[model samples]
Target: MNAGRDAQAAATERALARAHGLANAFLASLAERAVSRAPSPDEMAAALDEPLPETGSDPAAVVDEWFERAERGITASPGPRFFGFVTGGVTPAALAGDWLASAIDQNAGLWASSPAAAQTELVVLRWLKELFGLPVEWAGALTSGATMANLVGLIAARQWAGRRLGFDAAAEGLAGHSPIVVVASTEIHLSAVKCLGTLGLGRKQVRKASAPGGSVDIAALATLLRDIDGPVIIVGNAAEVNSGHFDDIAALADLRDSHPGGAWLHVDGAFGLFASASPRLAHLTRGIERADSVASDAHKWLNVPYDSGFAFVRDGAILREAFAASGAYVVGSGGWDPFTHVPEMSRRFRGLAAWCALKAFGREGYRALVERCVDHAAAFARWVEATPDVELMNPAPLNIVCFRIVREGCGKAATDELNRLAVRAIQEDGRAFVTGTIWNGQAAIRAAFDNWQTTLDDVAMLQAAVKDVATSLTP
Candidate 1:
């Protein structure tokens, strides 16, 4: 048994060395690599789908096969010019930390399981709170992404409302209880909407009020607040997804204070919360500190690896109660046990990447990153404004510029069709990418920038690509 174990360890070492070399090779050519690749072939699929062999292959051979199969099929979403979905590319420090975390394989659910993971998470949470100007005392959990983070906040809101109605929500759900009223702008993120639906709250039932200029109308919100008698959940969107426009968060917090139903403000900051880290952009996130709960995605704007998000709840005990579980075997140290506050109890060590990012890029480094990306957006928007065949659909308030292709004498229908075809064409062209979105009822294209590695040259290349593809598609 000892001999076999030694052999397996030796094999793993060889595999790790080979994987390291292959990863370096792949990353070195990321800038020149195709931003998008076609779907995998049937032959490649069948080659990978064969039955399991009685004698397994060596680890080094397995690693080689894995890369050989995956290299061509992979999409360079981490490339500098991938302006889709507001996804940020992995930074060097964060990637290193992620690899180490994977190697350690720590279950970050309990301090007993991994004290380093738990403490690193706690320290990282504190640092984030300080960076974002959130209250330092709030309880936070590292989640998979903003979707789960939003769910964490909404779960707490649901439980708080249930308790106010004189029942145990975590113990017994709201089956017979009154449904809590949720209020938000018409532009509430799809992730937060999904959270509401998952928590038994009706999605269509959310009361929405949009101002004439596409923000939430404070007057309309006030009227809705006065009508509700029970607990209410108000979502203050730090940044709207389509155009990256920030809602009046400070104004929303003030309005939430006036809600007759005793509102719980849950801010889905996602990528936008990073604005608070910048001295120049901190004004965008004013009054986020007073929110009952807030959600953010490090992977979106912090330039960390994928699957890093945070949920901060003002009431720590309430957060724990909302998702509490107990077991005789799953013992926890007296320190902070992450499983108490999050939905999952068997989560991996996600905090290491975030901690490494914060440590490597201190306050100044982060400030520069946030400001640089915003500048890139502004510069790209200028390019869009200078061009004739594009219409700026929604203003670029932060890092997302929403525009659509415009043809002379063509109506909205024609422009929409042209933009739809342009999305596919640009993906096929492979120089750059901009995602599709509907802005104010018109099909539009969004150039959302977040990757740290993106430079002015990439942005310029993207501009040329857009003009070439979009103009060719039009008249």
Candidate 2:
């Protein structure tokens, strides 16, 4: 038995060393690799799928095989010039922390389960509140992503509203009671709508308000709130997804205050909340502190690893009551149990990556990152405006440039089709990557600059690629 144990330990060490080497090689090659690769489902299945072996196999060999097979199929999202979905590149410090967190394998649910994980999360939450200019006393939790973060905040809002209506929402749901009114801008992200639906608030029943150019109309919101009497919750946007425009959250908060019934204000900042880190762009997030809850993605502008988000609530007790579970076996040290605030009971040590990022970058490092991305967006927009064949689709307020191809005597359908062709051509060319969106009812292309590795050279290359594609399609 001693001999077998020794062999197993040695085998594990060897496998880890091999994996480390493979990871380094893959990261080193990001600069020259294609931004994305098209791999068929059959190809992946053939390489990864097989019947489970009846006998044991060598661990090191298995790791090597998986890495080699998956390398070609991997997308270069971590590389520079990936301007799709407002994604961010992983920084060195954050990647190192992720490695350590995976090695430790801590379940960051309870204080007793992992003391370090729980305390680290608490510290990270405080740091995030400070960075985003949110109230420092608010309760926060690391979530899977913005979607889950939004859901958690909405859950708290729903519960708080139910309690106001004389029922414990956590204990008793709103099945046959008066329905709470949810108000949101038409331009709000789809994730917030999905959160409302998951929280038992009717998505179709939401009072759709006008938000011209991504800024919610305060007058329209006031009119809707005047009609809503009972429990109410208003969803606000810190930044719109397409044009990077910000809603007047401070004004929304004021509206909530003036309403007949005090309403819970939840803001979906997502990537836009990072603008608060920069002094120049901090003005964009004015009045965000007044929100009852705020949700943002750490993986977006924070340049951390994938699947990381944050949710902050002004009422800590309400947040805990909404999600905390009680059981005979469940015990807590009363020191920061994440399970009380987040939906998941078993979650990864996600706070490690965020902590590493904040510590390594500090305030100045983050400010520079946010400012640099905003500058890049402005520079790219200038290039777009200079190009006669392209028309700016929306105002490049922060870090997203929305544009579409234009030509003389080209109809709307033809122009949309040409832009679609341009998208296909540029993506196939593999120099840079972008996605399409509908801006003011016209098909437009969007270049979302959030990746830290994206430089001016990559942006120039992207501009040239788009021009070439447009020329080809128009000719």
Candidate 3:
């Protein structure tokens, strides 16, 4: 072998070994690590910023130095007590699969380029559909995250809507076409609004569908749909962010039927759709199968690594027409070409980790994981109500607990301030991590239990931290 090749191979082995050791150490320390310890931006920059060297350095040494610096800034999100958002911890199998994907370096953009990537992705998509109780035949693609997934689904909807209006929106653009009415509840996720903006359907043009407490008022939606004269797109929520309440999707599906212009039903199922994985929680996503398109995040509840999303469309032909690229260099393929269904042409091999995870855990394993998180949230809500100093802001419909601090004889403003202080204090205490939010116009602390590692002891620790902080801040 050439001397250069021999040296490179040895370097690669050493670098990989260093990475593996660092990963193991991090995972092992999660039990005792603080959920968060954010380093100041200036400090982090000082640690990581340096001028590029003219000469090559030892790859293994560089890896070790990077790990040491990066470890200081990492949030213990994979730990049991992390409740900041609907973030899921990576499973061992998923992490291992991710490593394999990088080692293989497969560009999963074209079917001909990597047949294994395409077929494995197809299998993973099928498994997800079955897990979520969606139709197995639905066309789906894995994207970077829910945002991209929502954009892909909305692109298809825009085209479908344009066709109903006797125009090809993809080719002709939205200039001469009749305005497509994008209807959404006020509770719809911000990502949906972003999707509309990205699709050139002005976000301001979205017709507000009045839904109180995250439940779509079917009669209100019907009246709005009845009056709409143009192509329609209705966005529904599988799980509302603050309360985790699910909209009546079946009712939304019925309204789509009687509309003047057949409405496109799209569900933003971000973290909530995982509820369907649990038999006890599946009722929340009832009639989700009726949606014309669905957008969800695998990174959130699937416990996969960052940046994995799913976009599913009932009409495969329409999805392909909306996104499929054509050029002399892009060869025709009988196999599944991912670029045909998704927005990206150069895609990462994200499906491998998701596939490994689903295969490792199976259906029953996921059910237990999801159900346990929901149960934890429910228990935390109960504890909040039982504790006189704290009050539940909303019913724990799924896996999010929103609560506020209450002080005897304190005014509303004072109480809100105390709750705000409590949140900040608890976060700084470094025992557990939770986020602050406003629920029903009141300042509140939100703990979303989605991490599979979280246990009852972790929940107790969170309760204690909040109680201590709130009591200390009380007047």
Candidate 4:
């Protein structure tokens, strides 16, 4: 039996090696293109459908067949031209670490179960804290993404706030406690409200504050805080998703200091938190360190693969008390038990990918890469400003540039249709890809520069394509 198992393992490794090579080649091909061809429903069903095996077959053959069928259907979101969402291209070191993590298949619930994983996570967390200028003693946990990280941070805030009001909300539910009001900017991510709903706090329970340039309106926020009767949790944006605008953290922290009733401040810095790493952009995120809690995504500006998010809290004891599970099954005394900090019992070894990326790139290397992307975005914005048939929609604050294709002698509806048609043409053309969004109730095109593989030449090509499409549409 041991011999058979060893043979199967070796075969599986061989198959994986071959699959990796093919996948890398496919990714390389996408550098010169925009969007990948979408697979039809029939193609997807055929690739995913399988029968239960009555008898074991060769693992090598099975792996090969799986890749062959699935490769064409896979979305090239990892490619250079995928700029629709707030997604970042994964670094090679991180991808390789993910491969090793899958091979280890360790459940990083506690140190005893996977000491190496726990230690690595601790190291990564410390490194990240230092990188972002967070308090060294603060506690953090690896989460799936910003959504889960926000959920965890908000849970901690809720617990800490509940304690001040003489209630153990975690132990005894929020049955009789005053309703907790969550205050955030109008441009805040929808995930915050979703988190409230998941926590049994109604979505409508949040008080929306007006924002200027996507940052929280300090005046509006102060008014909301004064008007609210019960405990309040102030949610601030580090980088507004729509325009990459940052909130005035310094001013917000000052308000927190003067408020009579204690208010928990949570910074939702999913992709914006990393701006602190760049000396050029660090000033934009001033006072981020003063946040009571911060949630960021390692998969975004950190350039790590997916399933990497972090939640940092100033009070370690609060996080452990709020999230720690106690029962007959759980072991009491051990090195760091991740389940004590985050809401997960069986989590993958996510720390490996983050640690590997940091070790391979070093701090300066990532900072330089991010700076380059920002420069590219600024140059693209300048190009849009220069073009006759293009109109700049918003100031390119970070890496996202919003603009629209100008239609000659066309009405608002016609111009809107032209912009929509232009984006579709770029995707269908496959040389460049961009998506459209409504900005200030006007349709506009957005080109996000987050991929490390993207270059000035690619940007120029995309700009030229947009011009060609717009020129063709003119009557």
Candidate 5:
């Protein structure tokens, strides 16, 4: 019986190895293909129709069949042209690290369970803090994504604010506490509001401060704060998702100094915080260090795989108090456990990929890549400006360029329709995909340069494709 079990284990490992090889090959090919393509409904249904086996089957055969069927259904978000969202293409080092992480199968929840995993996380966090110019003493936790990071950051903010008001909100809950006011710019990400609501703070409890050019107007924010009663938590954006516009962090920090007892300031820099790596763009995020807490995503700009986000706090004690839970079954010592700092238990070794990527690229390598993307975006913007038929929509502040198709005689609605039709045509006919977005109440095409593979030649190709599609759409 022991021999038979050993043989089965060997077979399973072989099958898993084969499956991993196939997945890697598929992902590599996808990186070279168009970013967006959906399989037909019939193909999806057929893939889902396979019956579950009642008896044991060859694992290699099962994995092969599934991969063959599902390959067509996968969207190439990891490809260079996928610009619909602020998604980052995984770096080669990070992808390899992810594969190794899965093979290791380590749960990095506590130091006692997996000391290596915990140490790796600690090293990565320290490296990140140095790279991003954060305080050396700041504590951070790896989370699933920006949503969870924001949630965790805001939880600490709420706790700190409540404590100042002489209420133990974290311990006793918000039962009899005065309503807390959460302030954010009108351009604040919707996830912030969702997080507040999840914490039992009503959506109406959030006050919207007017912003111009996708940043919070500091004067407007101060005026609103003056009238608000009770404790407040001010949420600021490091980067606006739509236009890549950065808020004036220095000015906001100055405002924070004036209101010492009134509010707590948290910076939500999901994608924008990474800009600090680029000397050219670092000025845009000036004064970010003054923030009480910051939340950012590695998946967005660090080129790590999905589900890698982080929340950093200047006050580690507050973070621990906000999230730590004790249980009889769980062993506890005077050691660090990740669950004490974030909203997760049984977490995977997600920080491994990030550590690998950071180590492999080093700080200078990443800074060069970020600066290249910014330059490419500027070039694309210049190309659009040079072309009479293409009108630049917003300032190319980072790696994103927003523009629209414009003709001499076309009306606004007609121009919008033409741009939409052009996007669809380019996706379908040219096998090059780009997406459209509404910018400042006008329809525009947005192309974000995030992938390392993207270059000036690729930008020229995209420009040509746009022109071809627009010409074809002309009546």
Candidate 6:
């Protein structure tokens, strides 16, 4: 038995070493590698899928085979020129911390299981709050990503709305809370709506106020609030996904405070909240501090490893009231358990990556990163502006540039097809990757600049690739 155990331990060590080598090899090749490849379905299954083995295989062999078989199949979003979906590349410090977290394998659900994990999260939370100028008294916890963050923020908002209506929403279903309206601008992220639906608020309960230039029309929103007599939760978009336009958060907070029936203000600041890091761009997220609950993703702007975000609620008790799981074994010691604040109980030590990211890149470093990305976006926008074939669809306020291809005499349908073909052609060329979106009833290209590795040179490459793809397009 001792001999078998020793052999297994050796295999594990070898497997880990192999992983390290493969990881570094991939990172070194990212600069010159293709941005993405369409993985062949049959090939993928043949490589990754297999019948269950009665016995076990060599650990190192398994790792080696998987790495070799799946390398080209993986999307190289970490590459500098692969601009799509507001994705961020993993920073060195964050990658190291993530590896360490996996090695530690701590369950951060309860403080008893991992005091270090809990403390690390607490430290990270403090740093993030201070960076965003949020009140220190606010309660928060790390989550899987922006989706879960939205859920947490909306859950607290639901509980707060329930209290105002004299009901315990978590204990009792949302019965008789007819039309608990969720008022948001047209620019609200879909995650917020999904969270509302998850919390028993129907999707129809969402009443969208008019938003001009992707920012909430405060007057129209106030009018909508006055029309609604029931409980309300107002959601603000810190950064509109397509245009990177910021809603007037201060005005939204003012409306929330002034509403006759109190409104729980939640801000979805997935990548946009990082604007607060830069002194010059702080005004974009000016009133974020006043939001009742705020959700943001570290993976988007902090350049941390995947699966890291946080949701902060102004009131601790309300947050606890939303997701306070209980059990005989879950005796959360040391007066605090991460599970009390969020939905998950079996949680990974995600704080490790975030804590290391914040430490490695202090406030100044983050500011520089944000400024650089914003500048890159502006540069790309300038290219679009100068090119006659490309029409700049939206203002490049922060980092996203929405543009579309133009045909002199083509109708809407032909123009849309042209835009689609152009996007597909560019993607297939694979010099740079960008996603297509339908902007204001027309097809357009959305280039989101978020990765820390992306430089001015990468932006230039994207511009060249786009122009080449456009010029190569046949009538």
lDDT of 3 by residue, 412-456 (tens): 888788877877788778889888887767888889998878899
Q: Per-residue alpha-carbon lDDT of model 1 for 1-475, expressed as tens digits?
A: 6998998899889999999998898888889987876554775585566677889888889889988877666778777989988899998999999999999999998898889999999999999998888888899999999999999999998888888778878899778878778999888899999999998887888998885445678788888888889888899788888888788888888887887667899999999999999989888888889899999898888888888899999998888888888889976678888999899988979899999989999989889988899999999998888898877776787898888888889887888898888887887788887789887788888888899899999999889888888768853
lDDT, candidate 4, 117-177, per-residue tens: 9999999999998787888889889999999999988999889888988887778878888
When summed lDDT is taken over every stretch of 10 residues in candidate 1, the lowest stretch is 38-47
Q: Write the per-residue lDDT of candidate 5 for residues 273-312, one digit (tens) a residue.
A: 9889988889989999999889998887888998899989
Candidate 3 lDDT score relative to the true structure: 0.88
Q: Over the stretch 406-468, how does candidate 2's per-residue lDDT look in tens digits?
A: 999999898888888777777777788888888887888999998888889988988988898
Model 5 global lDDT (CA atoms, 0 to 1): 0.82
Report the candidate with higher lDDT, 1 versus 6. Answer: 6
lDDT of each: 0.87, 0.88, 0.88, 0.83, 0.82, 0.88
Total backbone collisions, model 1: 0
lDDT of 4 at 426: 66
lDDT of 6 at 34: 79
lDDT of 6 by residue, 348-397 (tens): 99999988888999988889999999999999999999997889988989
The weakest ten consecutive residues by lDDT in model 2 span 32-41
